[model samples]
Target: MKKPLDSEVFSSMLDASISYWRQQGKKGVWIKLPLELSNLVEAATKAGFRYHHAEPDYLMLVRWIPNNTPDVLPANASHRVSIGAFVMNSKREVLVVQEKYGRFSGIGLWKLPTGAVDEGEDICTAATREVKEETGIDTDFVEVLAFRQGHKSFFQKSDLFFICMLQPRSFDIQKQASEIEAAQWMPIDEYAAQPLVGGNELVNLITKVCLARFGGTYNGFSPQLTTSASGKQTFLYFNGHFP
Candidate 1:
């Protein structure tokens, strides 16, 4: 005789199924089961679960666990939110800018075009806008590469770095007079030799990985500091531009 599905057994099966879907990269669970399992479905729903499909034979369920961790911000040194872009060119040369003002000023360092993500602004949007403003080159593709957290700061801070591919024949570049002092293209090996702004180790790691995969020119430069409206300190760095 076949074994019947009990509450404990059903719940365990559901948990395993959810885990399997997540490992496969699905965002949420969508399931269809025999209508005979109505009692089981009711029990699950009563347990803080919800379903999607309308068909009686199929059930869709979602059980969300909230993330209680506080979002990190930069000025708080207690928390920070920053975004970076790796802009590369076809000639194996990356675009880099020299910092004309703030913290690591006048130091010849190379980095991606990056900046603090403003409150209420999407990270990718902020990155694209910052790149255009800093290097006068608009990007065509913005692929998120990695996210990292700083270990030493009293405030929690995170960096969102992206791989931005530039448009062909779009190198008519100019620096923002108020933020960047100079902008130009240089070979990847040469650009890597300069000191990085913001003294970041995470940025360096992202650069190494990108170089190994794409094998193209890298770009961007050290971040410059600017005072926020709330009187907090923030830094901006650009990796490279896509267009």
Candidate 2:
């Protein structure tokens, strides 16, 4: 809808539209106002519209018309998903990288190849992709070893980090020059003994879990192909190895 020069006109039109929608049994109403039309926000609230979300350039307002039912609108995205690859070779060497940035930078801490999952990308695929991008090592996704959830980590948003097990298909390390300071195959024992890994409780536990998987004493969540209710094929991750 176009922004009106007069707030009184916008209010009248909004009221009329709401009444018409209610008469037609419409349950939900959304109004998006551009920054230039912010003057209409007060008019919208006066008409019972509440804030749904906002961006730098716009504001979204919502209202529910049905008195018998409750509002069921979903909120904006609350969590950012990331993936870390734990790749161990037959010789007990793990693929590790030292990032040029982030908390572990300049500390000489060799950590797993990790990156944020892209939109519409599977977690398993993300793990392999991060490994390939950071180290130039080809790998096959195995299973998710574990996951860590932390609040207010990035931009005041919650974080979900999935630790995935990957099998190496190539051994050469060509570290990403832009982001990685170094990448190599470090021995599992040495990787686990890192001061940074041992200092952080969650990282230490994750390292142990990776070791357990390597020792064949622990099984991680594996993905199985399945069809969703919408007739879309997707992967459902779980301990499907169990009987």
Candidate 3:
């Protein structure tokens, strides 16, 4: 609100707006309430608004104006996307790091350079960027080898973690000081011998897949740049090598 009005005036204005929207045949109405204007929530609810979603700075409320039609407003994002770079060099060594934080911290588990995908970032770009950021190793995005989906993770939201195969361009390691405790190019065989890898079923499967990819016996989803009907540029990932 530009100026904080008393609940009486705010309710009056809300009623007028709703009437105007109904007259215009609007199907959905959304209102964003700033944190400072929380006192107006009661007025909004009395006018037939319900909670939609919320963020750190604001609360979003919505109302379906057309009673005859179903509410078709899309839901907020329900999944977080992350990536793990399976970067291999010509020396048969995979880039790995010991994070200074998270579950792997202080456990001596050497894992791939991994990070969450930033807003508006593509999966392939996220993999390469994560590798460069954590290990200072430049890499070329190859393909998305595999992905896992898990529910009830990270604030009760589902998560998609993609395993990306990347070919290293520059092998020099300059570990991120704040997040990575140590980083190195470890022999793939030796890296797979770690207790964490040998013990976990999922990790073992991933290791085998990486070996298969290295041996040219496996293929993953490759990104093809394409434009939608709306003329927006985007990547369509699929098995491009298929006949």
Candidate 4:
């Protein structure tokens, strides 16, 4: 819908459309409202509309007419969040482990230590836990270096991964025998030169980026804060956009 809606008549106009859609045997109705028109959107909500999703430019509102309709919003719409530890020691060697299971199993593809984030888990803390579990090394998360998303993750669930830059506090590699075939502190140059990584164009590119940002030279991504007019705490940044 257009911006600067006629708020005075929008409620009536929306109600009339809903009534028409119901009489015409329409199963559902979707109304796209621009992000600025919160008042008009609230009017539609009282008229029995529910949210589907929100993109940067607009918000999606869906209305299901049928009483027997299944949920319009998916129950499992959430993506699985995981963290990867890009741990480095004093010698600038990165911690990597060979997978004994999962997608890259038995292929000798070295990857940073990673695992699924448990419920109520702090992302930074989870990074260290995964490193300990896989490599038997104590590490401290310094900052988030990068992140990636996979739309077609296993079982068709979406995946969100955080690549954390960590400082290795303790040494002595002990690979988790079950899931990890071997773990080691490979020199960054040697790790990047591996055939499995170097031959793969994308992996090699990412390895270079990680190596470039190694150490605290590329640190500090802390979110800025702000106070609302109503004396409430609010995030200054939303979905990568500054308000």
Give me the candidate number with maximum TM-score: 3
> How many clashes (backbone N, Cα, C below 3 Å) per candidate?
33, 0, 0, 0
Query: All candidates: CA RMSD in angstroms?
Result: 17.4, 3.2, 2.3, 12.3
- Candidate 3 displacement at residue 49 in angstroms: 2.3
How high is the CA lDDT of each candidate model?
Answer: 0.61, 0.90, 0.92, 0.78
Give the better candidate number (1 or 2) by lDDT: 2
Tens-digit lDDT string for candidate 3 (1-243): 645668888999999999999999998989898888888899999999999888888899999998899999888789999998998888899999999988999999999888999999999999999999898888899999999998999988999999999988898899999999999999998999998997899999999998999899999999999999999999999987557
* TM-score of every candidate relative to the true structure: 0.49, 0.83, 0.89, 0.61
Candidate with better TM-score, 3 vs 4: 3
Candidate 2 lDDT by residue in tens digits, 1-243: 464558899899899999999999999899889998899999999999999888889999999988899888777689999999999898999999998988889989999999999889999888988999999999988999899899998888899999999999999889999999999988888888888898889889999999999898999999998999999989999986656
Give candidate 1 misplaced runs (Cα > 4 Å).
1-78, 151-169, 195-203, 215-243
Q: For candidate 2, what's the RMSD?
A: 3.2
Q: Which candidate leads in lDDT?
A: 3
Off by over 4 Å in 2: 1-12, 23-25, 32-60, 65-72
lDDT of 1 by residue, 181-214 (tens): 8888778877766556224575567768667646
The regions of model 3 sitting more than 4 angstroms off are 1-4, 19-27, 34-39, 65-72
Model 4: per-residue Cα lDDT over 167-189, one tens digit each: 88899998898899899988888
- Kindly report which residue stretches of model 4 are placed more than 4 angstroms away from their true locations once superposed: 1-71, 215-217, 220-243
